[model samples]
Target chain A: MADTSHGAAPGAESAPGMPQLDFSTFPNQIFWLVVTLVILYLILSRVALPRIATVLAERQGAIQRDLDKAEELKRTAQDAEDAYNKALADARSQASEIVAEAKADIQKDLDKAIAKADAEIAAKAAESEKAIQAIRDSAAKSVAEVAQTATADIVNAVMPNAADAKSIKAAVTARLKG
Target chain B: MATEEAGNGFNIHPMDQFEIKSLFGGGPIEWYSFTNATLWMGFAILAVVLLLVVGTRKRAIVPSRSQSVAEMMYGFIHKMIEDVAGKEGLKFFPYIFTLFIFILVSNFLGLLPTSFTTTSHIAVTAMLAMAVFVAVTVLGFYKNGMKFLGLFWVSSAPLALRPILAVIELISYFVRPVSHSIRLAGNVMAGHAVIKVFAGFAGALGVWAALPILSITAVYGLEVLVAGIQAYVFTILTCVYLNDALHPSH
Candidate 1:
């Protein structure tokens, strides 16, 4: 390092005043600047900048691809859910229809069974009425016969042949008629 | 420490650090001479290459720390160029990025205990600013032809005042390069000089030098901040000037 140890030289001399204002060193500074700056420009434009740009673009692309995949999966899930709902609705409607048909069939069978019961009861009642009529006739006949026998016995005991049997029979018949 | 003080023992040569001499030996500086300026300038380039090229050699999907840093710088400069200069101006991004990185690296490297601050020199900054000025002027003409001069003419003004406004605009336009160069160089130089002055105080103050040491630390921190800011300012101004070239009427 060339220290400027020598006291400040006169302004007219070789290295005097502000070294910055000194024109002698201007070329050296400018030349290197141009060289260094040009090289830096080349490196930045051609080598460095492109690498950074590529990394950023790659990251962005990866993110976009993942998002698209996720969206597709979400859409598939939604479709499956929609299909399940449709199947569930169909099953509900089918179940109700089967229940309605089963109810109609059971109702018809019940109505048929009730009609058969009513016909059987009517036939049994007719036969029971016929039996009651027969009994009543028999009972009337027995009563008449008994009355005739009693009259004959009484007449015989009281008088031997005085009273006619024909008269007694006719009297009994009139009483019964009255 | 002994060399910093003069015979009087209270002297401080804050400006001595800026002196440039040949690396080989003391002699008259030739146009082709390799000096301390050239050495630090080389270091600046090497730093940029190490960070940008070697760091990104793998080009991994998951970047290492160095790669991320490189990518961040790339993106930042890229966005800055696009934002200030419009999309068309991005064609010049390489040049602008080079300028920014070199200056920024040079400024930070200079913060090293004995390192030279290349950006602090007017010759370097002037060259850069003039390069921008020349390139933009050429690009403006190349793109818009005679219409590029419309940057100077303000059509919205009253007809009588248009010419006066154009003169003022022209003067400002010409002043752009001077201001651009000086802004970076001047900021860097001032910060360095202040630190040097404080360091001198620290030397002279001896046992009670803690005060100047603290001030130096604070000023050094500010200088680091200024270094980055000046680089940003320089690059963004370049973009703005390029924008004017691209859309002269605007």
Candidate 2:
């Protein structure tokens, strides 16, 4: 190390008016300080600053991208919620319509069955009336024939206006007795 | 209190006397002579160089103990700069950290027996301080241009107070190196002188004097603390000056 002894550092020591500026003496100290400063400035402005700025920029950009993705996911979730609600509404209306349709179909089927039963009953009643009418006519004709015969017999026997109604009377009595 | 009493009583050199010397060579090139203070500076530089060289040689994500210790120191200083001066202002971190480490190492190294205290010498401290002063002034103007001189006369002054304020500001600004250098040198020199005096007292104690030794031990601890603090103050002040340069209105 270079001796800086005779030039004792002035502070609490050293007399006033001693030469303060001696470039010839402390050249190396000054030189080293300058070198340090220049090198530090270069490193800061060039190498370190650029790398740090880039890292920070990339970090911020990544954050922004993530935010965009999150926003998109949120929108998709909102859409899904809306669709779910809409589907639920559709299901509710469809269920009620289906219930109403079933009721209407049942009513239609009942009306049709009632109409068919009425037509069948009317046809069967008309056939029964016709059979009863034919039976009544046959019964009336038989009664009339019996009365006519009886009257004829009575006339012939009693008046005897012609050859013996006695034979006819006997026939009638026999008929009656047998 | 005990340490102070011991320190006050013992004196290798009279407390009132201040002596400065340059040993080994003399004459025209006397400034090139080897010095006790320069030895301290050398020790400081050696510590910094060794630390950086060994610390960085085996860089790892999950660091080994030595590397981690180095990283912790780096991180600590980095955070200090970022916290005090913005990350935008962090362009000055390396220099700030270097200044701090060098000063701190020098102060601590000086505490050893048969060692020198470089910062106690005004020329060394003054040179460091002058460099900071020059850098601050130049950087203020360079970064902000001629308008940077407004740091003295502008901002919070009333129109009438401008001249007076300018005078005061100039005086204060010029005094920056003086106060900075004086504060460091004075503290170290005064503390070392006190410790030497107390150490002498310990030797004078007779067979029945265990108390002086204990007090000497206590002064040693306090001196260690002061050494670290003085270095810290010097470094932080440098950063503060840099901050003012970066943001002159501040």
Q: Highest TM-score, which number?
A: 1
Interface RMSD of candidate number 1: 2.4
Write model 1 residue lDDT over B1-250, tens digit each, in one string.
Answer: 4343455576665556676778987688787788888899889889988998899888877789998998888889989988988899888877888898999999999999878999988999999999999999999999999999999899888989999999999999999999999999999988898888888788888798999999999999999999999999999999999999999994
Off by over 4 Å in 1: A1-17, A109-178, B1-8
For candidate 2 chain A, the 10 contiguous residues with the lowest summed lDDT are A12-21
Candidate 2 segments whose C-alpha is farther than 4 A from its true place: A1-178, B1-11, B14-29
Per residue, candidate 2 scores C-alpha lDDT tens digits across B184-216 of 878887777777666666666776346766776
Give TM-scores for every candidate, taking all chains together and pairing residue i with residue i: 0.81, 0.56
- Expressed as tens digits, the lDDT of each residue in A1-178 for candidate 2 is 1132233334423322122223333543434334444544454345443433444455568789999999999999999999999999999999999999999999999999999999999999899889888988787666555644665666656665764545655665565557
Clash totals for all candidate models: 0, 9
Candidate 1 structure quality by residue, lDDT tens digits, A1-178: 1323243443435332466776667888888888878888888889877777887788779889999999999999999999999999999999999999999999999889888988888888888888888888787777767887788888888887877878888888889889
